[model samples]
Target chain A: MKRFQQNIRKVVPYVPGDQPDFPDMIKLNTNENPYPPAPEVQEVLAKSNAEQMRLYPDPTAHQLNAAIAEAYGVEEAQVFTGVGSDDVLAMIFQTFFNSDLPILFPDITYAFYPVWCDLFRIPYEVQPLNEKLEIVPEDYYKPNGGIVFPNPNAPTGIALPSAAIEEILQHNPESLVVVDEAYVDFGGETVLPLLKKYENLIMVQTFSKSRAMAGERIGFAIGSVELIKALHDVKYSFNSYTMNRSALDAGTAAVQNAAYLQETTARIVKTREHTKQVLAEMGFRFPDSKSNFLFVTHPDCDAHELFEALREAHIFVRWFDSPRIRNYLRITIGTDAQMESLFAFLRAYLKK
Target chain B: MKRFQQNIRKVVPYVPGDQPDFPDMIKLNTNENPYPPAPEVQEVLAKSNAEQMRLYPDPTAHQLNAAIAEAYGVEEAQVFTGVGSDDVLAMIFQTFFNSDLPILFPDITYAFYPVWCDLFRIPYEVQPLNEKLEIVPEDYYKPNGGIVFPNPNAPTGIALPSAAIEEILQHNPESLVVVDEAYVDFGGETVLPLLKKYENLIMVQTFSKSRAMAGERIGFAIGSVELIKALHDVKYSFNSYTMNRSALDAGTAAVQNAAYLQETTARIVKTREHTKQVLAEMGFRFPDSKSNFLFVTHPDCDAHELFEALREAHIFVRWFDSPRIRNYLRITIGTDAQMESLFAFLRAYLKK
Candidate 1:
């Protein structure tokens, strides 16, 4: 081995979902919204002068944060922005999870949680989800450094009520509770309003899913001014200009067109409901999902085989190889036409 | 006090230059390229479909990385891309500086160096520069966890010869050495070619400077495949997709226009030389700068007072409040017309 090689940090990186570049592929693996961003976003991108890129972007990302603050009816001081929600969550973990006690989250939640924990050297413990793939609020009532989880949990798509999440928040007044609402726009109830009452509550949202701007990479956190201030301090220490100027302008435009966000989210929810009925009739068992994706399993079919078969036919869906959820498939709700194509492929593959 | 507050990892954040947004401000505080980006970059941003932002960006940032690799005559695997050079350097520190030994750099260098060490819990010691503000190769011959310093080091703009930097690399074969070439395109001698001979060497460059895309936030590191691979692992562990689609497209276009880079760099170099001669005639004394900025001090004027005076007149230049550099000013080279305006202001202010 080379002499300097021994000092390298060794760890398994978080693997993102495969993004196969195919002209005809139905890309439903990463839970990206099928619809494009608001026309105002496109207009902003087109109208902004790229020559202005000679100057550094506003380090604080003021324009985008102001728009989010206005949209949420919060003071601008309550909002913190990053490259994406992943970056925001990573910063949150780095800043708040430094205590000796292990942070707590659901075992079957987002895989990136463990990766971030490992990166920051924060001890973490995963509470098991109930047999129905539901997060039990009581399970997180124990002592912990902090607690964080997706509201509509990934791979399962089962959402806890705002009251249930508030239950966990109430039990642990001294711990920070991060409510990641990445998919809340689709249907999940948000605990955002509770931020006015809970000092340690941080609600994270993304432009990736319902807002259909994942390619532009915008996400934000809203909380008490103190928490937001602390997060900003850590973020500034890490990277000053995470978001570029064009994306900031585009995000502002997207936030201003509030009707477009509502209409696109409603369209996706309609498709999700229709798809759920179709899957139930096809003998797939699953919980009532509130998010844009469905976690499902069949009595006789092997999930790994189904995953491979779908990929072979240019249809992509997420399937985890973990212990509890190995047999389940997580399918993102696409446009009606795209979902129809997926159903046709699944039917032939399963010999329905 | 809040109980959770005790666990928050706190540190003083790096203060970036004042980006005072005024319609008629001279704006020379941050070392941004005075010229705009290549016309190809503007065309690429305008022509790319913003509706395609519904999907996530290519996690690898393939097109931009490939362009940089091709431009530098290196294999694609030898390059690692990030949001900016700051992000790249932060990742490098997290990935490589894990040994018990303290890393070493000049006392007067980029302020972010010590900030990052504090954030990552790495021990570091600063070596004092010579009276000429030049880095002494022998000063870094001691043991270190790793070494990194900007070529044409910040605020001073005094660059070391290629042989001088190679001497440090030769002496510290067991430690990783990172050469930050953020300002090298102006006139500094780059050790980029030494990558073929040294496995522990990593050269970092940015589009924010000579390429004129600071607002786009694109930067990269070039080194051996093993070191680059390690960096990607840490970066992936932190955030899977740092670059958004539009910025990646813009960066690729910028890299492809090699003629524009050369032309812009030459223009800046010409302006810098002219400014240095003009400052010399105005009784200013400083090191011979090899960058797009001049680090200068006048015998009769206080740097802080001049900084404020310039600010009042809307001609922003950088002034550091450090021990040795408190009386020195760092002025970025602007257009010929802008420099003339600065000279005119200086002549009137100094009554020269």
Candidate 2:
């Protein structure tokens, strides 16, 4: 006799990436930015006062939205912000995807998508990734209430080119096409420019990845004014003030300091390239990554065994238990020094 | 054509309380605490670091939950926290309120309730308060999946006794009864003690009101472990990290400075009593308030006029547009100096 709704009763919550603590471990899991954000974020946080906290935060997140809108060359009316991309995605699931018609998404993308579908009682179909680990445009031509997938898809880091996504958008003119660009700035191109052509396209991006503000928990969506208005209606009806004052302040600073973000993202991308070369020299074959992480499986051992071996040598990398991805590991690109340590330890462990 | 589900197209977002700027004016709307929080909270804010912002916030808010549980004499498992009481209330709507069975709530309490019900597509019957503007326990005994209303009910500031609440809880054994005690610490008693006897009860509280951490946005729910688990699942699946690091730090500090909260709440309660007397002397009729605000109506003037009159005088209070309560003005009790100015301005406006 559970008092909750039957839909909620059956919901299995999304499991976030494993957060582990090992005193001397090299942590390359969870795909976090290896460097701190622009120093301006820290200064903004430092200047926040307790007196200001007595009043409610700006419900509109005005300044942050303005900066984001300016940076993206979009109107602030086209922007909607939330706690994170996960939060924004949750609202999208409830707002745009709750229908009798099935929603379409990649089977191998962010695992939270299925959990959200179950929670919202939205019928959905998993369009299996193609043999090359790509989202096939033809699969989405069939009727679906909506479409969503990461640009550089998670766990695999393979990017779906904007043209391929635009193809799906054109095919599914009546369905909402949501492109989650969580890892886009790392390598892939943004389809934000195509938004003018496709009024049904809603793009969600995060400061967590490119701007190194993951801990600050700021994510926003851009779309036609009508679509953004629907998102706003849902948000206001729900929490009203989803992001706090500090997050807004830090986020505004992060968006304004585009140079700092570009420098940090470029550095991480360069380090990822170097790490891939080192792995290739050690005869390890991994997917060509367009994001901050690499998906790799070694011929010398089982993926889980390699994960354990690296753990024993004080290196932490992500390993999903789902059957399809169990054979591979997702490794976040670390700093030059951290990657040096990771490479040295991996070489020693693979030699066994 | 738009791609959003039909259900979302009809959701009208709630209008938040006005946050007007009159730098030198007395502000009283929104029930914000008149005094700043303890200096310890400020100390905690000053010490917040960029490093803490790098790692995600503790998803479960373990440390703050421990403090709240200890203060309320409950097990940590009995608690769940969110961005604010509004956020906690939103999750409760999605978690326990959805059913084939129609829900029931007061027509005049917490204007946001209907918005949530509409957004979630939950069928609900609005239960009207008694002639005296009180929530009658008997009104809730009719068929309902769950019950929810504010303690020291909003706008009107009338509270239902615990025994009356117990009667409704006893009648609805198979449903969840949610008591929002957002303003309980101002004067009303908390029903947290009922958690032991009633497994179906969910009590929502917040730091925003009594603890003066409104801008920081921290709130929690206390229920039986099963109910808390349901909320935990909803939170995890939707927004894994609702509270940011600074909130966790400041909330813990606010609770730790118990003496400050006690002293401040006592002062506000005293001011509320004095304000009630002043209203009575001015030939106004109002309900006896148990919260930090007063609900008053005068025979000689319009509530809207009074609201505008106060606004012109650089004072502010809340006015709702509902037909039943349109004649009443909800004024938040503020510091003695502020209230004195308000009274003086009111007397001049009335005579004019």
Candidate 3:
């Protein structure tokens, strides 16, 4: 421990979700998509020439970024991709946020934000969510170096309206306002259209959730050409070929088959709606989520107790150890069969 | 540009050798292996399933690290692999060396060191190589927080004996002496054994050169468990799956075929010997190299002019813009046929 930087010592590591080896569990933790990626992804990956593996992947990830740009209606220069959204976020933190001024983020959102800030020796101020567990745009008006929080914000699955995001961008003209749209494709408004108006606006998205490519570790950012260039500089100076060649090939196929992603996301959203109705009928209080996950809490039900009981019944859900969100369970939306199993487990666990 | 970290402003990016479109040129500029990777690499990468790509790669990269540890004769806890040695080195700069204390590296070594130090806001002292282009271990004994230089010093192809390296490690008892053995398998002895004695030593090696897996982007470090743990903390805080699954699989296979690598490196070293004799016959001077590359300076010709002339003739070699090494050309050792063509080109160019 004495060998680490002073900042590293102060930071707690990011805890990824439990990747259980058992076959019986209906896995809803970590918000991974239950469905397989688009069939075209397999076709492209399988058909790739093995000889190409001898060469390094394109450092710019040009083709994948172009596909992402086409999907988001931006120029290729306005796009940047990394091994994953986490990778992209890490580079962004090191690139734009390391400053004398402190960064601002929601206290209840993705836990990795604080870890990254700590890792980069960046000062940060956490803005607490309002009483209703919503991020008020006004709260982010404080003068800071940057602001980042997931849109359709993680765990809570609440998305700020595009207009509200634009309002914050207007106020923080000098500071970079990064909107992490990791779950945006599942169900949420995106601030991608605002890139033309705001050079400091960067929207980060991942193929892991909707494209069902979490294992492939592909994440990208859409921003003005200048902001994207900054990310590029950091990426080149850090790890040029973060994404492997196969990933580029697979990601390009996934983006090309945008309809597949849309249909799958739509199916998950439908399943989530049905699952939410089931939870509501069972007397659970939860926020109306825009993302592909539901946040639920009950007065008498202990979150950890439910989490354990669900595990016993072969269902998995994410639980936070933090003070505010510890009482709630963030359940990922899955296939109808998985959701049915999950609902059945909750009913039996609650009855006990 | 105004928004980026000021430290990165003046940083000179490393330009990798131009991979030519024509197959005729003797391709030796970037020090890539002339041979193909192991057959297992192709088979392993072919198994990259679509389902796997949909998920995130293992943040810990346990499988690749396990393979590296097994090959290097260390515990997995003492090994860490990254996208490339560049990425791993970048993490090292941020994690261990980004302090007020000045870090140290050879003046004429891997050019990326100063770029990384600048990017991470780490102040560094460049200890110049002796007149013979040899890294004197005594030069590294100074008030420093860390030390790093390629094991077989780049361009010059000079290697520091493991005993000399061990002596330096003995002197810098408190500092992290990072020996980058990117070209080690070709000739130089690895300080892997020193890992058992010195907790402060970190040795980095890559599959790119000797194993012919550059395109796959796999590099790793062998060090004491505590140092590796610190690097792991930095890795997780940055990007969990820096190594793609296919890369991990291919790298694991590459290590398993060490005998094949030994055979290929032997062939390359033979070719290097043959080429060195040819260059010497043409009145060029260079330090004797132990790796798969040659560093030569011709008295009658400007190195830049020769590089340009070679490029015009569809031959490529690396020339550093740095003042100290500008007059020299770092040529990757190619096949016998490739070297013959290079010799023909030089002979003709010199006549012109």
The candidate maximizing DockQ is 1
TM-score of every candidate's chain A: 0.98, 0.95, 0.95
lDDT of 2 by residue, B1-352 (tens): 3545353545665555577887887788888888887788888888868755766777778899998888888899888898889889988888887677788888889987887787677888888998899998888887776788999899889988888889989988877889999999987878877888988889999888888878888899999888888888767765677788888888888888778989999999999899989879887899999998999999998999899988887788988899899999998889999999988887777787
Off by over 4 Å in 1: A13-16, B13-16
DockQ, structure candidate 3? 0.44
lDDT of each: 0.90, 0.84, 0.81
- Residues A1-352, candidate 2: write the lDDT tens digits: 6554343444565554456677787778777787887888888888879888888888888888899999999999999998889888888888887667899998899988987887677899999987767778899998888888998988789888888888888888888889999999999989899999988899999988888777788999999988888888767766677788888888998889888878989999999999899988887777789999999877776889888887777788888888677788889998899989988887777777
Q: Write the per-residue lDDT of candidate 3 for residues A57-79, one digit (tens) a residue.
A: 77778789888888878899988
- In Å, candidate 3's interface RMSD is 3.5
Q: DockQ order of candidates, best first?
A: 1, 2, 3
Task: Go through the candidates in order and give each one's DockQ.
Answer: 0.73, 0.53, 0.44
- Give the alpha carbon lDDT tens digit for every residue of A1-352 in model 1: 7557999998785555587989989988999988899998888887768779999999888889999999999999999998889988989999888899999999999888998887778999999999888999999999999999998988788899988988998999999999999989878999888999999899999999888999999999999998898888888875778899978998998988899999988999999999989888888889898899999998889999999989998899988889998999999999999999988877776685
- Deviation in Å, model 1, residue B22 alpha carbon: 1.6
Residue pairs clashing, model 1: none
* Residue B5 CA displacement from its true place in model 1, Å: 2.6
Give the interface RMSD values of the models in order.
Answer: 1.7, 2.7, 3.5
